[model samples]
Target: MKESVNSYVFHHCVTIPTIRKGGPRNNTKTYSTVDDAENHLSPQHFCLPHTLFNRSFLVAVILLELGFGSIPMATSLDTSSTYSGILSSSSPCFVRPSGSGTVYYYQAIQVTVFAWGMHTFSSSSLMDTFSCLYNETFFPDRSSQNLIESDDDSNGAHQFRIRLNLQPGRAYILVVTTFSEIVTGSFQITATGPMQPVLSSAQPITTTASYVLSSSSPEFARPYAYDYNNVPYQAILVTVSMTGMYTFKSSSSIDTSGYLYNEPFNSSDSYRNLIISDDDSGGNLQFQINASLQSSHSYVLVVTPYRKAVTGRFLIEAAGPERLELTTYRHSAGPYSCGNKLTCKAGGLLKIIKSMVISVGCVGLLIGVFCCRPCTNKRKRTLRQQLSLLRQNPISQANSIPLRNVSINTGRTNEIDRPYTISISTVAATYAEQPPPTYEAAVLSSQR
Candidate 1:
């Protein structure tokens, strides 16, 4: 048996019409096989749409296939395996016998160029520059029969579209290339979902006051304090309304109530009408007196509360009385005094004089009784007589010698005598006679 060596040939050609500014345009068609051209062409050079041209190209391919008789080729192709270039390359082509009963298989190669034009073009015209070559193979192989595609331009993007009749259950590699250096980029596609809503609750509010006034224009000096919870608070807008004998007064003077008149009291002012607002937390508000007020001037100051979305409560309390205006008097040294003067006038001086006089009179009376009573006493006569004698003869000469001698003797005699010697027996006169007492008694007895 003689062994036959199989030879293969394949051809690929592409022609691009040069675009001119103003040129005659012609419609042209291309075919790959003689049979394809003959069956499809209309005597003109044009072939059927998408049909291959050039009969010689098909003949050369067949002759090469016959040269390699009895050789087997890959039935499937992988384009990436054969494609290679700095910027461009070709892809591997796979062949099996045409849908006929023949078992012969063929292999081919295809060249592709990716070019980017600054201007946009139709997709059909963009893929026309590609070419392919087919050859017969003699051996069965398991390696890939695929190729990578390439482009010729490097300055900008070059895009092309390709058509393939891919097998449903088989995997294949597709290749793209460029003439210029590959400028890599990325692309992505995505999708999204739906949206939603939110709901919330608001805060409860409260308020209180420090002072409330009683004048129609009474100063509602105390501020209102407000509180809130759960919701955000913004500002407190205060409005003061009055009932009874009062009205809201907005003035800058003493006669009227300057309630929320010139807004925004500053730090330097001594008083203010303020409505303070804070966040969900609580804060203090202040109002202050502008002028004094009188009693019985009844008034009511109302406080209102507000916030961003939250509300607040308010209360009113009265500031105390105005200062007392008292009249002063200068005291005179007289009766009808009220203070220290009255105390001095009442009984202080009289009590002092009466006490002095009583003390002096009592002392004088005591002295008079001591002197006169002694003189009046008969038993004290001797002492009075002696005192009188001494007073009469306070100084005496030789004539006084007698008095001195007398006094000396008297003093000596009085001293020498015993107290019992001066008896009543000598001092009393003779008793009445009881002469016959004894005799009478005797006679009576004899008679009896």
Candidate 2:
């Protein structure tokens, strides 16, 4: 029995039937051992032996599979001395000081120079007091730009490294020697700037929305083919939603340009797959790209500066329709489709115009009926008065009619001429009855 228990643990085998608390029970379905333990454990209850194990054993195994004992590292970056050659210095070059200062040599290429890593250097043990001097003047004289020194290369080992950006064809001298005396000895120094960092080394971006990029961040993409402001650039992956036009733009304080690539940039050679590159043509020095994109395609966007070394905060924007539209597409019956936006507004406007015209016509009709009713009553009253006057003095009523204004140009006979009266406006007559307020009004009235 003990041997069977040991075999069961080693082979991960289990025997069912005849397992009892005090001893073996013979009445149950008898089996010497079970072929599959999982089959016996979950669906059907097994009379497991308490002598060999407890109830928590299966759960404990599950916990171990869940990595209970395995823990992830708490931190990623390593600041220990073990990172010796990881961000290593350039190859140490031998230099000797003959005359003024110890001179080391280096050259820069292209229109701009991007310092890669921190400049680094080391001095010989023979010199107790020494400093590293760097300047652009080829041969130093009184007028040559006074030396910039790096006597301690951040590690404080009496080593030296001073970073300098030298233009093409401009000669620079990096001298390593004592303050006053010209020392003649070999010194190991890295005659180069820092090594350029890369895309993977940049901050990882995973979001789909707009984000801000600063020169202060650990990101910038500069293809080797680019001679201008490799400035700083950040990598972003965007998913194209539809097969249509999409715009990527930047609104930045500094002049900026945006470059789109079909793939993540690894080498300068990847620029051959560039979709489009826009400079100030977008807005300011900012970039804008409008491209016909395929649905479900992923694009890599690189945001950079236009002028070399100029970097600031910039905003990225994407525009144009990528979703389904009802009005634009004939098949779409969506509530607010392209057709709905315009047609809905137009229908509302038509309804409003129609209602306004009907309301105005109805009001004018009502007003006309109301005004005509009073005029009709007055006409009947006048007719009744005329009839009564006809019964009394019809001749006097006809003679009582008011006369109209007669033009002075009428050719009437002077012999039978009656008293002619011409009525003027009450305002003008009021003014004529009085005196004019001023000389202008008096003149206008008198001329009239």
Candidate 3:
């Protein structure tokens, strides 16, 4: 009987049974233990012993499988680390840096674990063999705690959740290990919040002008103008005031020979040339005159020891309005005399009158040249020829005339016999002249 029990345990413990056909039976029966069949198999052999032994073997195998094949239970514990893990053993774990800053705050932390084990007894008996353990450690304090609990319930698994109220700018560590069997697991934790930064202030400087000139020896000192406040200044509103001496000369030919000498001057040569420099501060901004000038002969010397800003367009309000007005200044040199110095005063007067007539005739000629209509084919042909000549030699024929003052004959006829002295003065004139009212006005006036 002992041999039979040992045989049954060994066969069922390692291998499952395979069905086979029965062939022979023993007529004689023997009893070795009390747990054997009651009949002792005296009359015939009984199969009850084989059936009872198989049933007991199956129950033991089932119990052993249940205990060994199941996973262990686990629980979470609180810690300062941003992350956590669970396993069969406990050891120090490191948390990665969360943000870029001197200080860091922890919002919350979490952990999880999984465990497994095995047994050699019945299901209920195997439950008593397995267990769960949770270990936690706090930083700075170094204080630690452990919890042990049975994990023998259904499926053999357990889970625990931990919440952490951690201090900022600190670190902590955690370790976990198993007690009875080879069960294992891991845990995780997280942290979150905001960070701060540093900054600095702005500085200021004075503005000055930078100049560029078209000519190598520019006549005037380039003026520097600017506004301070740092706010943008409007280029159009700003104006520059300049003061300097200007010299003018008229065309000698017109003074000595034109018929319109006494007539009111209507030509561009009547005015003085005023050139203004256009240079702003270092920003290189340029100012340009929006209007054109017609006068060139007359000159003015303005001395603006004082200046003022005015609101009107093109009108500069002077600090001393009266002093701002220009006065005539005479040069040491006398009126220019060209060609023969006549001995007869009558001849001088006649020459003056002839110059006046010639001036008028020139003006009339210009009007006729521009206004005459081509009434006939011959006139048109003549006009075309004149236009061609004018185009071919415009500067030589017209633009070369210089500016000069008109001279009136004031001496007596016999006075020309002696040395005649004439004085000349420079005067200021309008910067521009308006054109004749119409082409007809310009042409008809020529008849006189």
Best by TM-score: 2
Evaluation by lDDT, superior candidate among 1 and 2: 2
Q: What does candidate 1's lDDT look like per residue over 62-87, in tens digits?
A: 33333422222112322221222221
Query: Tens digit of lDDT per residue, candidate 2, span 211-255?
Result: 455657433345542554235566566665556445566777877
**TM-score of each candidate?**
0.13, 0.24, 0.13
Q: lDDT score, residue 352, model 1?
A: 93
Cα RMSD to native, each candidate?
Answer: 43.4, 28.0, 38.6
Give me the candidate number with maximum lDDT.
2
TM-score of 2: 0.24
Ranking by lDDT: 2, 1, 3
lDDT agreement of model 3 with the native: 0.26
